[model samples]
Target: MANTWNTDNAGVSALASGDFDGDGHDDLALGECREIADENIDDPCGPEEFAKGGGIHVHYGNATPGSFGYRQQTLNQDTVGVAGVAETGDRFGAALAVADIDNDGRDDLIAGAPGEAIGTRAGAGAATLLFGGPTGLVDAWGEGHSVGYQQDTPRVPGVAEAADAFGAAVATGDYNHDGKADVAIGSPGENAGSGGVWLLPRASVNGSSAFTPAKLGLPSPSSALAYGRYLSSQ
Candidate 1:
């Protein structure tokens, strides 16, 4: 028999409802991903950034107030588009998180991706960042590709790829004072292309729900991706 039971968010996706706004009524803090991409692999590029990897359709779900994965939808134009990060070019978008890392009283999200990467698309490729706006979650930042220092360095959202990516993230704290939450991305490897993580502090960020796609300027090896969970649990 196949094992199928997970109490924690690890190894599985979930959602719930609560007062993320700290308001009397409940709010929405959800995790969305391309659990299933409804469209065909148009193959934006000949070789394609996802050329070698298996194509993964986009899958996304929404939360009910404080509930994570409370409500999900798998339809084109239903929600945000590809994070645009090169790493995630090949049908990526599965990892996701929703927590109040910034402590803005309202809940926020942190996306994770291991396979998300861009091919040699140059300017045509960029990174991806979708922020929550007056409407809902929307593709709000970065293009969809990593270049120069950003490449080999998955830590930063700039020039990084949220595509075909995988890994994990944990809430640290609101390093900034933007009434939002903060999070850190991981790239379990070593220095010099070994991979790294990105630190996203909350900002007064508002508008089309776009993020600048930044990298945490931590010391070299900001901290390996494998042992990143220590901060999330503690």
Candidate 2:
């Protein structure tokens, strides 16, 4: 059987799959990282609108073979369940990670918007966590739906600088051996271009509280190291 899925504006820049609905069938998340200015005329985004941002789409699975059906959800900064306002250059779905972060027997989602700017700190980057609910992934920001997190030099305890490009990469694992999964966010533009990574504990994430992450970096004095450019859990 041949199954195909499609989205507008050359979507599907990134892809990840898991049992997002807890129904035994796997679901897919597609990252549409570029927003087209005009679909009718195919107009390109102007310099001022470079930060118009993009979005992610979740396709729920069905019992039918090779079918996701029409049950789907769209997510972005502007989405009802998402936290924070959608801003230009956020690239909300640039990178994705899925796992049972809360030990709820349901898969959760993590999306990296490495282009997201914080205050005057352009490209400071951000990430969003969407928890799965009884029916499936919560479609909007609410009591149990979504939370946004970011890495800053002050709170994350690392090299201080702007345009750090945090959230450029993400990974989850039991870094503390606590049985619960933890997240590691990579900032490839930190330390005057040396890069760094921050580890967020599972407890902190589950509690939905502010946390001071443990930063990691290389021992060398090399510039432009980009240590956390990519990450994975063993």
Candidate 3:
């Protein structure tokens, strides 16, 4: 299959990237969904919906051609024959973050899947974590691999407490500096109308041939914090 260089799909909304494998390779992350640009296409993204619903997908690579492969890793509402999953719809990975939590030398992903929104077709979203391994991605559904996610209502009190809506996410550095990585999200347009932020700190990554993904939110201080408050770069 031909590899896609620039990840700009009409079927894909937002695109995010980072070294998800800790292999020193920055992987291309995409959030699939439809757009609701008022009165049309060719509109400028002055911070508005661009695309709309599929799911989230990631491709590893560099800027030059052939730096990446056709292979990919993905997560959706559909269960891979697993149980205890409440099944979701039209939900897609609105944002993505990747890091090497636990410093096990492997990378992992954190995705934001917002649900449907009012006054628009956009989703409100949730979060996801996918672990990496030697062969590639150690996804939850596949064989010889294991996966987990943040418990519902994980908690980000001050971030978007009054918002009731979780938006895009961006992963930062290993907060505790344990040599691992972490996750962060931004919730713009809250109830009070300003905006908020949320973060997820990855704890134990790999153990016993399994990949466990944990999530923690940033402590939302009552006063205003920095935008991208908990976000960091390589």
lDDT of each: 0.32, 0.65, 0.45
lDDT of 3 by residue, 56-137 (tens): 5567675565565445655444435211132344344555555655456766555555453322333444455655665445
Which parts of model 2 are misplaced by more than 4 Å? 1-10, 35-51, 139-144, 152-155, 203-219
Per-residue lDDT of model 2, residues 30-112, tens digit only: 76445454555432221223235767667788888777734766667776667666787777777777778777777887777
Task: Judge candidate 3 against the unseen true structure and give its global Cα lDDT, from 0 to 1.
Answer: 0.45
In candidate 1, which residue ranges exceed 4 Å CA deviation?
1-82, 85-94, 99-106, 120-129, 138-167, 170-172, 175-180, 190-195, 203-225, 229-234
Candidate 1, residues 31-82: lDDT per residue as tens digits?
Answer: 2222223246432112222323222222223343334333222211112253
Q: In each prediction, how many residue pairs overlap at the backbone (N, C-alpha, C within less than 3 A)? A: 64, 5, 15
Best prediction by TM-score: 2
The Cα error of candidate 3 at residue 33, in Å, is: 5.4
Per-prediction TM-score: 0.42, 0.77, 0.55
**Positional deviation of 180 in candidate 1, in angstroms?**
5.9
* Model 3 regions more than 4 Å off: 1-9, 17-26, 33-53, 60-65, 79-91, 116-124, 138-163, 175-179, 203-234
User: Model 1 lDDT vs. the true structure?
Assistant: 0.32
Clashes of 1: 64
